[model samples]
Target: MDRWTWPAWVGVFGGLLVFAGLFLPAVVWQSRRYGRLSARRLLGTAALAVYGVALIAYTLLPLPSGDLAQWCAEHGVGGVQLHPLQFIADIRRDTAGLGLRSTLTSVAVLQVVFNVLLFLPWGIFARGFAGWGVLRSTVTAALASLLIEVTQFTGIFGLIGCSYRLGDVDDLLTNTLGGLLGALVAPLVLRWMPRPAELVQDRGRARPVTALRRWLGMLVDVVAVSVLGAGLGIGWTLVGYALGDRTASAPEVLTGLLPVALVLWLPLLIGSGASLGQRAMWLEPRWSTGEGLARGNLPRRIIRGLCGAGGWGVLTLIHGAGPALAAFVLITALAVPFTRGRRGPSCALTGAELVDARAVSPAVPRAAASTDR
Candidate 1:
């Protein structure tokens, strides 16, 4: 056996450490929050299986034989070295070949299609963890790709004397695009093959939370709402100011508009969070109608967060006529229900309901389940 280098050891150890840290947290959080969705369990298991298969293939597959490496060396390009820029240049040059143009186009298309397919599972698993949304799911997918790339680059270089893996910037770009593509497709997949809900069930009946737990939950919700809303509001204000009035400093406008924008948009942000965040936290937010947060779903949640309060923040800072008027209308409408013991506009728009986080039983493994639903 060949001797492993320092880099190899670092790569191997580092990969393990990183994977362990990330995997453990994701599993714990998902298990606790979503409970058991048989569909999610199956999808997760399938993803792991595919990943393992890919890893095995990557290891056992023959390297571009000695001839190819020798050819590369003769051509003045160092073999088994990190040359990201050079690799991209080579790709561009090769794409211009006369006879190979058609073949290259086909290959490029196939590569993109496969890449998109590869991350579909990641998107699905991420949605189960964070709820279905393009941005959140895409972010999760990108992070996952980064971890994989770093592990591969570091581990391979350490174990072997040379960097056997070509760490291309293209991979990061492609992987993220793929992940987003997958996330975009997830909603459709979910609609057809819904996630199973038996994997994380609790054995006992739902127990009412003690005072401490209830208080803690409320605190968590409040902090999450405030931080998320404030951050989004600030971001929108900066963008609005930057695009509309280049003369005024974004900071100046943002600071001046912060309080009013926050006050007007607070209900929407809090109410949306009350619905979506509760779902992510593995609790169902039900309204007086006995319906859980009206599948206000991901799209609605994002609009409420980004457009409602966040937009109001930007408008407030800019003193924009349209947004301010819209904000006033929304605020007034929300306030109307307050007279009758109902919640604010967000609750009305999304049909906000009650929130309950009771544990059920873990789902039965997919393989063990009967075909009949």
Candidate 2:
């Protein structure tokens, strides 16, 4: 291969690795979580599709090859046949056999630095979407690079047609290391963008509510919580069964346990959502003078949600009907005060003192509101 060709292949491989690292998981997770799709995601998918097409074109298309002598003969532009083995040979020659001293030199350091910088965006986007801490981000990055290397070595044969691509394991190591470094830097980068994570304190005078309105809101909250908990519990049980025995039918289990699962999730979901969802929906949970909705940080929300779901799991194990059902009802009833008053349990847990949004000038831009929330 010509000098230019070798570098071009490297560039292509690196670009594809980075693109896959950033976009593939984004597509899967976002779709699962929100159900609602965005134009940006659509465009991203389109771009990836185009890249796939280009890879096919590059692999199947003919290209000019041979020395200047053959070209000058005017018989025809000498065409060189693409071969996978030749590409692999070239890659090995270029990257293999470095002395320890050379490996530790400035050039190697720079290479490592460049690799880390290349995947910084991947780490940032992964952390933003997954809410996965550093460990998960690093593991994900490593797996992405491994997939790319495997694809290259296999000549994209699994899906796309065979191509003249040389896969190197070193590439995976370097790429993953890069992503890990990037993950370390993501927090610092996000910190500089303060408006993206500003906490909104919802404190104000309690609005008067009719008895009917209060009753309806309570019903809605309880129903929503129960349904979510039950679904999650039954879903988890099915997963556990599937993992334990391949012949186990997940749908059958889900069908049988759903009612109990709903019973389990109801109190937790309503308890947690009453305060947080109300805030998100532009409503407040207020009582006598104590002030705003409880802070209900991410950890608290996750715990409450999981606890509600777990309540159903406990019911499943104990095989009791009356007590389990009663406990769920009791929990839901307890959450009502938190949903209603300023000093409710949720508020006490979160330390959120509400303030009037109207009184505070809007410092956050509408464009950045989603991130802020």
For each candidate, what TM-score against the reference? 0.35, 0.30
Q: Write the per-residue lDDT of candidate 1 for residues 1-373, one digit (tens) a residue.
A: 2221333343445545555444433433543544422345544544444454453333222233455445334532233334444444555655665466564565554454555565666676556433557888888778766665654555343443333455455555666777787677676655544443433345123333222222333333334445555676667767778789545433543444444344433433453343322333343333332221233455555454443334434554554477666665466344633522233344346544222334321222222211111
Q: For candidate 1, what is the TM-score?
A: 0.35
Question: lDDT by residue for model 2 over 1-373, one digit each (tens)?
Answer: 6532444354456546656555434433332333222345444444444444333333223332455244335433223334423434544455568665554454445444554554555565455433467788888888776666565544344433332344545555666776677677766754433221221121222233322232333344444455555676667677778688545444534543454445443334453333322322233321122332233445555454444434434554454576866776566446644553332233344443222222222232332222212
Alpha-carbon lDDT of model 2: 0.44
> What lDDT score goes with residue 56 in model 2?
34
Provide the lDDT at 325 for model 2: 61
Return the lDDT, model 1, position 66. Answer: 54
Off by over 4 Å in 2: 1-114, 192-373
- Model 1 misplaced stretches (Cα beyond 4 Å): 1-40, 51-92, 97-113, 128-132, 155-157, 193-373
Top of the candidates by TM-score: 1
